[model samples]
Target chain A: MSSTWLAEAFAVFGKDWRSEMRARHSVATLVLFALTTLIIASLALGPIGASPGERSEVVAALLWILLLFAAAAGLPRAFVHEEESRTAAALRLAARPSAVFAGKLLWVASLLAALEAIATPLAVALFDLEVASPLGLLAALAGGGLGLAAATTVLAAIVAQGRGATTLFAALAFPLLVPLAVLAVAATRSALLGGEAGPVLLQLLLYDGSIVVAGFLLFPVIWNP
Target chain B: MRATSLSFSGVSRRFGRVAVLRGAAGEVAAGGLLAVRGPNGSGKSTLLRCLAGLLAIERGEIRAREEGRELATADRRRRIGFLAPDLALYEELSVAENVELFARLRGVAPEPGLAIARRFALPAGRPWGALSSGMRQRLRWAWALLHAPRLLLLDEPFQNLDAEGEATARALLDEHLASGGLAVAASPVSLPLPRITGELDLAR
Candidate 1:
């Protein structure tokens, strides 16, 4: 990207971050939802009670599900709030469509990364997850978080234009995110089990890249239309 | 540098099964103003939005030109400043931050925006949500002119303004026109403009 484009995108990102800091909409929702879900999962599963094999398998799937649903709870607010407050038109006029997308993507990615930073360690401790490859786990979370953010950012823009936005966001996002969820769960499982996680990590990275490219390609139409 | 001009013809727009604007045509040369007069729900805002490239027309063409060269969509958007009732800045942000955000996005210096804010007597530290309606309207004017756009599209420009705010808006509009900036303003009532090059009555 050109320097001007990068500057514009960063401006957008900075604006969103500042606004979010004041509003605390996505952050509050994401943290509350993730924490509540984690508590319920810990209570239901009763920490480390499951066999070693089942612990990795169940915790891996549950962790991704928790993260995905928690992200959904908050991320849609990024675009939906703009429409609700009627600020989208001003933003649309002021910034390029791609820059807006990149900015929102950055904001969403940062939110997810923060969520992972908190939720992942808690999950590992709560579930007694055996992390055989710390690097592999980090890679999985980073790649998976980015992919989730990319998908949610564009989908949020699409959902913002229509009614029943929350329902619509979940309905659309779940189906599209299932593949990412599957890949994330597999990667986490492999990492926990000390298995070869390189292939799965690569797949997650490819998925993140694809979603980001597609988001850039499709956001203009979704944003402007 | 020659001034920019905007012209549109055979424009038609619809929402679902209902048509809003049909065959709407008007032109505003550089240093000219075009008033769009209509009743509520008469598609005055719709037409201005179409001209601003915020809304797409089902038929006809809207063209913006500079120095006799037709500008593309991106160029037109960049050169156009738009304000409407539904358009808003971030409520959580202070006036300075809002202006700075838009200035950066438009790739302009924030000093001009700050100057405009000062002219409007807006409190630099006041959050948008805390501002009164009149204050909000003044801030909107500051934002619209901050980028020094060549073309201005305003919908109901005088809606929430008190006499002082209205005068400020009128002065800004006049200054913009005097600088060879093209403007299209939509209002249900009579506009305060001193001179109108043409008018498009969308109610008809």
Candidate 2:
């Protein structure tokens, strides 16, 4: 990208970051949802009474699902807030659609990464899980976080334009994100079980790239329309 | 650089089965003002939006030119400043921050916007949501003039303003036209402009 485009994108990102800092709506919602879900899951499961192999699998699956649902609950606010506040038209006139998309994508990715940083260790401690490959775990989380951000950011923009936005976002996001979730679960499980996570990591990487490219390509149409 | 001018003819737009604007036409040369006068729900806002390239017209042509060269839609949009009741800045941001944000997005220095805000006597540190309605209208003017756009598309330019605020707005519009800038204002009452190049009266 050209320096001007990057500068404009960063301007948008900074604006969103500052706005979110003051409002704290999405952050509060995401944190509360994630924490509540984690608490409920831990209480209900109460230490997985299964084989070590099955325990890791269950923990991995549960962790990804929790993160995915939390993302669904909060990320749509990125664009929905703009529409609700009547700022979308001013933003549309001020910046290019691609720049706006990139900025929102960055904000969503940053939020997801931060959520993972906090929740991953918390989940590990709560579940009493051991990581066999820290590098593999990190890779899976990083790739998965970026892919999830890419998919949700564009979908949020699409959802903001229509009615029943919250319900629409969940309906649109879960089906699209299932593959990424599966890859993330498998990679996490492999990392936890000392298995080779190379193939799953590669697949996750491909998924990240494909979804990001698709998001960039599709966002302009969705944003302008 | 030659002065910019705008012309539109046979413009028509619809929302579902209802036609909002039908066969609306007008033109304004540089250093002139075109007043769009009409009653409520007369599609004055729709026509201004169409001229700003914000909404697509069903069947019509709108063109902006500078130096005898027709400007493309993107080029026109870049040089056009638009303001309406529905358009809003970030409420959480302070006045200075909002001005700076739009300046950076428009790729211009923030100094000009800051200066404009100061000229309007706006509190730089005040949050947008905390501002009164009149103050908000002044801030909108400051934003619209931030980039020194060639074409100004203003809808209800005098809304929610006291006499002093209205005078400030009038002075700004007068200054803009005197500097060879073009303007199209949609208002229910007559504008205080000294010279109106043309008027498109939309009937309800």
Candidate 3:
């Protein structure tokens, strides 16, 4: 039973990957938006020499803002594309609801990871951001990215059902993401200043866990409706 | 394979205050073809979706049983193949790739979509987006039949088909019925299949 679940989810994941590989539209849009935002914000900020602490806090906040908004823009593609293309019905009939949710969540998480790989380096290099604990910063980014994907993928499924889903996605995503963004930013700031980020990291992990559980439980209700 | 049966009783659905399907009911046993005919907004598609378990029925039970044993919801989904007018394949994928994906999702080895594609003269190497309306309709049939489901539910199954494509679809439906597979189809126009033994007209 578990094997079939895993196999079905993998099938969905592969299908999404192959389709995305052909189009690359969503990835291009996301990466471009993240790069453009980082460049514009860094240039606009000029050189902020106000102590390393203040600089770290501001830069960390800026990074989360960029990543969060980028996620809000792109993650909806996982479910929204299915809804728009009218393929969701075919999928619903073909795979289990939980399998579909798992597959979509995996796809969104992968996209988040890729976006971070590109955006993090650009943000660091362009902003001249200093991180005392690079490893801790990476951990925070991973946790934050997971949390962001978990929270938004379910919401994406919800909004995908409505007309004007794209616009509704933006309006619905921001409020739901506040808790994730706050913990992520705090952890990122702590990581940059070489402070103990373990507490915030733990909090982010818990948040990620809770949201993923919630998403799995709630997705069938949202999906089948 | 045991003879399959899809039975529904007093199935009703609503969108807000507007009831799309009220007290709609029917049954299609194996080797039987049931045509669901109605005008627009009569909930033909809604009935098909409810039977396929894609939509929740507000007040009804849709059961797919075999040899007197009821199939679970998940099992019923596996045994059923669904096609709708608006149902689409991956536009980025080739004809063969799209069919292969659906086959794999059904936990089956990819069969020859080539024969089906050739029957409709579908360009096997072309992306779905590049296919014409008739070709897309043909491919939808190919995808639907790849798994050889026990219960086939189709909505507006004859749309965008030329005479040849329509003939191909008819032949496919006939073959499914011959193999003791039950089929329920929704169409605005009459689909005169010799094998059709029952029908649910929503106009009432």
Interface RMSD, per-candidate values to 1 decimal: 3.0, 3.2, 2.7
Docking class of 3: medium
Q: Please provide, for model 2 over A24-65, each residue's C-alpha lDDT reduced to its tens digit, 9 standing for 90 to 100.
A: 978888888777877787677775466666667777888789
DockQ of 1: 0.58
Off by over 4 Å in 2: A1-3, B1-3, B67-69
- Writing each residue's lDDT as its tens digit, candidate 1 over A86-181 gives 998888888899999999999999989999988888888877777888888888888899999999998899999898888888889977899999
Docking class of 2: medium
* Tens digit per residue, CA lDDT, model 1, B77-194: 7668887877789999999999988888888889988898898899999999999988898899899999888789998888788888888788888888898888899999986685
| Lowest lDDT 10-residue stretch of candidate 3 chain B | B105-114
DockQ of each: 0.58, 0.54, 0.56
- Model 3 residue B48 distance off true place after TM-score fit, in angstroms: 1.3
In model 3, the runs with Cα more than 4 Å from the true position are A1-3, A163-175, B112-115
Tens digits of per-residue lDDT for model 3 on B106-174? 777666556777777888789999999888899988877877777898888878999989999989988
Residues forming the 10-long window of minimal summed lDDT in candidate 2 chain A: A46-55
Clashes of 3: 0
DockQ value of candidate 3:
0.56
